[model samples]
Target: MPFDFIFNFLTNHSLSFSNPSTHLSYFGSRIICYHLPHNSHRNLSYRSILFLLTIDTLICQNCLLNQQLYASALLHSKSMILLFSLPIIVLAYVLCRNIKLYYDLHRRGLNPQFDIFGIKGLMWLDSSAAHENFTRMCSVIGDKTFSVLRGATPVVVTNDVDLIHAISTEHFDCFHSRIPEVLSDDPITSENIHMFSAKGERWKRLRTLTSYGLSTVKLKLLFPTIETCVSEFLDHVNSLSNGHSVVINHSHSLFQNHTSYVLARCAYGHKEKNHRVNNFLGVFSNAFGAFSDFQKSTAEKITYFFPEMRLIFKNSFVGHFLQSANQQKFLDYLLHLISRFRSRTINENNNKPSEKEPDNYSLLEFFFDHHNEKKLVEKAEGQIDMKKVKVEKSISYQEITAQCKFLSVAGFDTTANTLTLLFNFLAHNPKIQDRIFNEEIKSHSDKIDFETVCSLPLLQNCIFETLRLFPHASPLQTRICTEPLQIGKYEFSENIQVVINPWGPHHDRDIWGDDVDCFRPSRFEKLTEQQRKAFMPFGVGPRQCVGMRFALLELKTTAFRMLQKYVVKTTLPVNDSHGKMVNMTVRDTGTIWPTDKLGIILTKRNT
Candidate 1:
């Protein structure tokens, strides 16, 4: 239509603006014209007519050329304007965002803070002394809630017990999930989802279902499983030391294997020895080791300071590291356990008259049976649903697998680290070891059961103090605010990162006096209510370690058995090495452990 309009307008150009003698015609899709007015065509020579026609054509061409030039000039001017203004607009936006963030943090009592670049917040990335650095910052800042940029991510590190209690419990709805759920392509790896990673309703459901397994009654039933493993652990240690002082450089490995064996029996309901079990232990060790390495890496640290690089880290090396073969193997082992348990359930159902004892139910079987009962309840309720919405109340097989996997890793790693640290402490302090063995544990040697061992106050204090001094989980809890809330005088907005520094309070001079760092198991004997609450080796509040009860039972059981039979000391060069005292240091993986290859010497007790 535009072409037609142009053609028609051009054809009428002579009539509109020039003499009528010049006429235009459309012929063979081309414009042509001729003049024949008053028969004067002969007077005007052919060259003259041709010259006139050329002049007219030039006028039309000039007009079109001017129009095209005007449009091109206008477009170029606009382009130039945008090019110059774009950066200014972007800079203005960034400045506003930074200003808002700064003001928000300032209002919350965090001022003079590091920007997202992590100039100050990157201190925690220093694995050698991250915890100490963080504490130093806490002391210097004189604020319980101080702000730091983690690679551009804003993190509020807190040492205030009240604030920790508030965020972790009082305002739990606003601060629930930790890191965003990592999506994995492998089904087994995906099964890594459990209470730790779950949020909202899913977390509630999973926590409730698994809580049954760790209940006092349930733990009482499972005590035999724990005792058996504790017995085996003592035997292993005896064999390893051979009634002589033997140096153990890898105490983590020793305790880790012990915890894994106990978890295997209680959680998976299997006592059979298998290659998969060893592989399973190695899988977690490798995965966690890799994760710790990744967290402490330059790339990950930089990402914290510069949040923009998170995608790059996630898509590149760090991302692949998370989905390591160890992770896959861990997932596979979980799947295998789930498969075995489900198969057992099928066989049990088939033999209806054979009435299996409830005491024999493994953690997995309980979850499965509980889920079935929940489904029946949901089905019955749905029959009278007012909305008629079909609610899927049945738990997925993957969910069950994830819960098992979570319990296995969380329970095993933290407990193993604690036990290792405890043994190291006892090895270095033979006086304390004697107190634990001859005083605390010897009384129960005749009938060493869960109740009897747990009844020993000194033994309990030993566990508590060991955890306090070397809380395996230093920054015990980390959370992100999901909604706006205030902690004390400080205001928090959504997505703000919060961390509870358990190590800080545990070692604070003011809280425990000048000798706060000293290994004093007696401190726990008369702890104030605040001090007792402040001592959170297993964390505190609703999101505190769900398996805490079980972990304690496991720890006491192991400690009682080992201290009953052995005297632990350090062979490392230090004063009072033989009598009881020994120097100790720590190395940080994800969680702090005794420095790698730090040797602990164990000798059989002359009972």
Candidate 2:
């Protein structure tokens, strides 16, 4: 008891002693520890400092005591040495590993150095001003292609059209799949891994299934359902307009109602419900809302920046934490919808419409049939290894949910941003709006069917030009190397990230002429060979967006209806500019978005 009390008193009081050696001597080892024998060596586990000091005294008793005291002094010095050295060792290992990775990338022609061990880069990426940061990144690295260290991962980012074409098309086999940011291998997330993440033959099969799901006949069938939704949107607009110019984005999002209804009918096999529990769209909106701004968790911030952390994070509690709470509303709704669709599919008239869901031959039902939901529903847990999917006749159930999730997001966010920017451009350029009304809108009948809108090339051009400006998702698209490959003179290792920046080439003076910054739909009229290859709003080649035709239809149909009835005007000045929409700011939060409020003036037109 006396020895324990002495050890505690000395160790606890040593905190304020400025010099560690002096503090150890002040422990009065001459008085207390002089009874023990002197032996320079003593064995004590690293787990406890108290045990270390106590054992040093005991070991000394077995030998002989001296005036200078024995192993007690040695223990103090050794414990302090180990404590001080550990952190420096850790810091050295971290620095060496990062420097080695960066050096390898530098040798491969990735230039100008990257953020110090990616700390600064991580902060910049996690910041909401990613677009602005990218512009700054382009300035330092130049407008052409360059590689940078995204954490320790080697990411090749480029605006080079030839290189983009070569990788995405000509050299497709070498760079076909993406490294997903969030690592998820759950039965549903793995099989239903969104379009970009699935690699090789499995990816090809998924694309085929999705492409078939959006066939011309299916689009034609789904057109009426979409048209009806758009009409309701226009009616809502009319009620707000009140026979005068009105702002479209005050109380709620500009296109939220319109997109929600369309997704409800097309993806959910039902009308959009207004109730809190049943409204899948509302729940879905709120779930992603959790990621907005500063709400991001610590685990999310780490994994989002480091692609290598995907596998580890997916297997952790953070993944569950993210899904169980923030996403529960939508997950519950999705499961409910799945149950309903499952019930209906087993009935006598499986392929036909039910009285309750007149538009029951939905995209949801179509995807389920292809996935062979019967098998998927049996084993709904654990992930499917996509690499060995040679004989798997159908995708799993989780794959079906994953597909619908992508559709819900892409179909809503991307199409919404395009419409927002389109309105702004049209509002500022009255002449272009007038030309569309006279040449396209007036030529067409009152009907806004899929076939009628498909024939409007000029209107289609406007949509193309707007997308050329804003792009389909983020200006940044990503892929990963499947094997050792060469692009130009640079040879890359397998699993390297290949980022395609559509923003750079889209605004390149060499490709789009000096008026590249201008909002001119006419530029798309006369295209050079290079320009056509450079234009990749919905990605490129076989891996391009499967819903391209559907997206175009939505744009044309919505634009036709809105333009036919209203003349758009906005708060922005019409002078000294060709629709100079520089006042508005855009950013990428997984997808491109207009951060400013989406408000435009709509004057009802009497035709």
Candidate 3:
């Protein structure tokens, strides 16, 4: 037999070596000596078989020992890991369960109230808990006194009209805008004309600047620019229609473009040629993508959990991008415009130029005039720091730019969302849509003037009802108390945040009656003269939306023009999901755009 065959044959037959000790001894002695190869070929073959048997025996013995050792280590390691992590996991589960239980209990009239320490107490009024928890808080607390939330923060929850009016209007200075950590953390937020800014002098100065720059007169002057943009928008829509039914993403590209163009033109006196297809819309789209990614990170969750995360991550990718692109663009554009306007004004002033002026009137020009007046006052008073005054003078340019950018973002998305809601409502309630259409037709003569458009009472009512039922900035308004103040029987100390739940108030049965959820425009019509004062869609008091007029005009004008041109219909079954809206401004944040699965189809209307 071959040497290999002999080795295998011997190894297989080795099982017959009955005594384990005898087998080991024979293998070791033969295997150790046979490698010398001084004997015959049979001796060599026997030696090779002995060597193979010895190696196999040793490997088997080692493997058996290792297997037992590994099993014992694995069992011990598993038990230790379980022991270490079990309590932590259990604690997390218990806390989450308690939160849910507390929320549920509050929702169902249990009225269990407790306070835990820290800033996380704001979580009680956060959007996640607002719907149920806030409602329960309002019912149980009843505006009698401010309750301290878990995190050592005091909060006042109320639906009482007198108390709300007192806090929002009468003693407005005592309970000014909320100072959110997000706003205070970023320079853009700190420097901008956000609604969340401090009250009194700072708010007064900013508000005055904004009013001058974005005033009704200014908006009226800018109307032609908006009209031109909207005309282009209509053309784009017509081109897209192309005789075939098309599914359009209304909130994304189309609205974004129109809005960007409107802002660029109105704010900077510059309009990009492909604003609808490129420019700020693209920037916003990219920024939103980056925002979504950043939001997914554990860092984002931590930042949300602790406001101090904002301090650490002040230069977050999303925040920086927003400031650089949106904030910086507007700032630079405004500053450049201001410089040019100031140079031209200086030349004109020296020459005693006529008040008739040039065609390129801008918001910057208004600001320049306002700044001059302020400078004159400071000069006469002799209390001015020329350096600080110079800085303050440049503020208008930056402030107006910030406000304009905010309008572009806030006004655009909210208006589009409101329009979507209105259209969805009309799709379901054809009668109401028809009423609006008929009113528009009746109101429009050969030419529609501003006064004629404004005169349509029913149209106004329809718009009001749509806004009330589906307010775009549903839960956006927040305010922090700077000083201890009483609202009804509740006394809220300084640093306590108050959230004005517009959606809750709008949907409240006590406020709007049992049919509050229903889309009944007649409800607005039937509102007693006294009741109308409490129904604030644009909010109330001095800190109310500054761009309310502009937004209203845009919405009304768009609705009227669309009604004049086309009758909107939906191919997809008109459902809530198809017309779902989101609250962008307030406590919660998510995909606020209407889904692609839902949309309205428009057909030409006969005059």
**Order by TM-score, highest first:** 2, 1, 3
Candidate 1 accuracy as lDDT: 0.66
Off by over 4 Å in 1: 1-96, 116-129, 179-192, 243-245, 274-277, 291-322, 348-353, 357-359, 372-394, 573-590
Q: lDDT tens digits, residues 288-352, model 2?
A: 63233334556656664455666777775767666646466766677788778778667736666
Which 10-residue span in candidate 1 carries the lowest summed lDDT?
Answer: 377-386
Give the backbone clash total of model 2. Answer: 7
Q: For residues 1-607, what per-residue lDDT tens digits would candidate 1 score against the true structure?
A: 4345444555556356344234322221112234345545446643454445555566678889999999999999999999999989866765666666777687777553756435556556434456666678777877766877654556788888888888777777667666442222222224335677765545555666677667888887888777777776766666665456566777778788888888887888865654324655776677564323234555555555446756677663566675558667777877887788778778868887687765565788777765642332221100122133333434666677777876776777778877876776666666777877767767664467657856888878878987787666664478777777766678887777777788788877777887676667888889987787689888776677888888888888887777766677765653322212322222323466555554677777675
**Full ranking by lDDT:** 2, 1, 3
Question: What TM-score does candidate 2 get on C-alpha atoms?
Answer: 0.79
Best model number under TM-score: 2
CA lDDT, every prediction? 0.66, 0.67, 0.55
1-607 per-residue lDDT for model 3 (tens digits): 2445546755677678654344445546444345445433233444644555666666667899999999999999999999999988856754665466455435433343654332344455543434445556666766422343433333445444565667677766665554454423432234455434434444555565666666666766766666666666766766767464344645334555666565555555554566436555555444432222122334444554444655566565655553536445544554565465568668867898667333355555565555432321212111122223322433444455455545556655666666666666676667777887775565565356555555667667777887777554534566666666555435555655665655556667777777666777777767875457657667677677777777766666666776777777765565432222333323223223443433667776665
